[model samples]
Target chain A: MTENEINHIFQTWLKQHKALLFKIVRSYAFNEEDRDDLFQEIAIQVWRSVTSFKQQSAVTTWLYRVALNTAIKWTTKERKHQDRHESIDVSQHIIESHQPPDDRLAWLYEEIAQLNEVDRSLTLLLLDGFSYKEMSKILGISESNVGVKINRIKKHLTTKSEKS
Target chain B: MEFKEMKKIWDTQNDEALYVINEDALHRRIKAKKMGTKRKTSFSEVILIVSNLCAGGVVIISHLLKNSGNVAALSMGAMMMIVGAYILFMRSQRIKRDQQTDVSILGDLENAIENINYRIKLSQSMIWFCLIVIAFTMYTVLNSDKSLLNIILISGFFIIGFFMSRWEHKRFNLGKKKQLLDLKEKLINEFEM
Candidate 1:
């Protein structure tokens, strides 16, 4: 496809699923600067990779995969630096933001934040109503594993909620 | 809470309030890619100037040695080669240094600031090395007499460069520490509120 045509297609797709980018960024970023940086970086990566975008899968699936990978890599690097600088407690940040008082949402974010990076991505995708197949594609995990993991996460959440 | 319960909250939450995509801003950023390219080109120009000066000095010394059989010319040529090699090595290292990635959201600002510090060091080192070479050439031009003056000046530059680099390194570390503390405080306050 021509460059202009490709750009148009990307722009259209970006308009539709741009919120997904924000969701991922918000889940991972610490502040406004980080959010803006991640958003720009994701946009650049998406634009760069648009040429290689095959039509075998949906555009949203591709976007989630790219966005999650970028966010995870970003967070891992930041965490290393934070560990060195000041022994700032990440749990404080996790707990303090948007408490939701009696709502289950805060608990959900806390649990998801506590999960390993890969599992966190999977859980977020599942929570967003992605099918097991779509989750597998975004996560590079098998569909069966996605199903197994979601069930396990569901059970874990239930147990945690009971304790609380 | 069960995944279903959490998902319900996630679904009902005001996503519109949380996420905003300014396409025009994004488009402007993409268009500004050329500015980054321009900065890189300017950096390359500095490298080119140093390399060309070193190369030119070598050619001149080589020609003088061939015609006059002067030991001084040969020594100058050798010195030029050393400077050329040093410049090339530094340029390659600077390029490698620029290629690092900071993917994390919280630490991205710190990493970027550090990268800028690294670039400043590279540039300062390049300038100092070039000045040292020029000082040596001046010493040679004066028939190698009063070599102590050249040595003192070179040492002074080296000392200054060392102190500058140390200061930059300390400042970078402090900035990183401050950023982490700020983020921690913000997060804490956010939780409290």
Candidate 2:
């Protein structure tokens, strides 16, 4: 495919699924600047990878694979240098009285922030409505393992939310 | 709340996640990225290049000027410098494992882990190669005449280099293996299969 054709296809994907890309980036990047950096990186990667896209699967799945793969490295590589696997715990985010956002989304983001690096990516996939099979496809795990981890992540989020 | 319910709430999440990016700007950046995607020359690599050029120049000049007993030793120094530059150039062109994004996450994850482990291994080997050469070069350049002191100093440098490489591997590479194993355990334990 020509570069212009690739650009058009990518532009459409971005227009429709930019939020998906954003959530993936936000999961890994600490701040706005980092988010922008990762976003550009993912964009460049997707643009590069688009022509090779066989479209055998959903574009969403392929896009998730690229974005998550990129973000995982971006987040883990720095932590790997420090020999730490646990990602930054954003559980302590307090909503100011005046700027009350959606409590569920805030809690959701906080809990995701607290998860281990692998689980953070997996749970985001789960939340985005990917099935066990699709998660397994994207994550390279078995269907059964996806079910197990999804339950574990859900139970943890629920138990914490209930207690508070 | 259950995940589905939370997901519903997540779907309603204001377009706070949205960031406007222009097509033309993205195209330009992609063009720029594609143009500049060569594996960057590392800081150590720059040092290697500069040292090689300067050292090679000095020794070759000394050999030509016919400094007493410097002829053979400086010629050897010049040759080693050429080899050093070649090593650094090859080091910069080291192959990176391609992340197979279109496959299973388990396979991709394993590939990622293997890539990290292999890169660490490459650096360790490179150090050993560079150490021997650097020691050889220093020995030849400093001592034009064969002497007991020359062998002893070179041996000392080799030993020091060996220990340093081991220490560095323990500090950096081992953690990557542990992280990989941890992920492995997390997967196996989660499924109990």
Checking candidate 1 for backbone clashes, the offending pairs are A74-B103, A74-B104, A96-B191
Which segments of model 2 are wrong by more than 4 Å?
A: A1-12, A29-34, A37-41, A44-48, A77-100, A158-164, B1-3, B13-19, B22-46, B64-144, B158-193
Model 2 has a clash total of 4
Task: For residue B79, give model 1's deviation from the true position in Å.
Answer: 18
Specify the highest-lDDT model's number: 2
> Could you say which candidate leads in TM-score?
2
Candidate 1 chain A minimal-lDDT segment of 10 residues: A88-97
lDDT of 2 by residue, B70-94 (tens): 6555655676577567756665454
Model 1's CAPRI class is: incorrect
Q: Estimate each model's TM-score.
A: 0.55, 0.60
lDDT tens digits, residue span A47-71, model 2 = 6678778989999999998888777
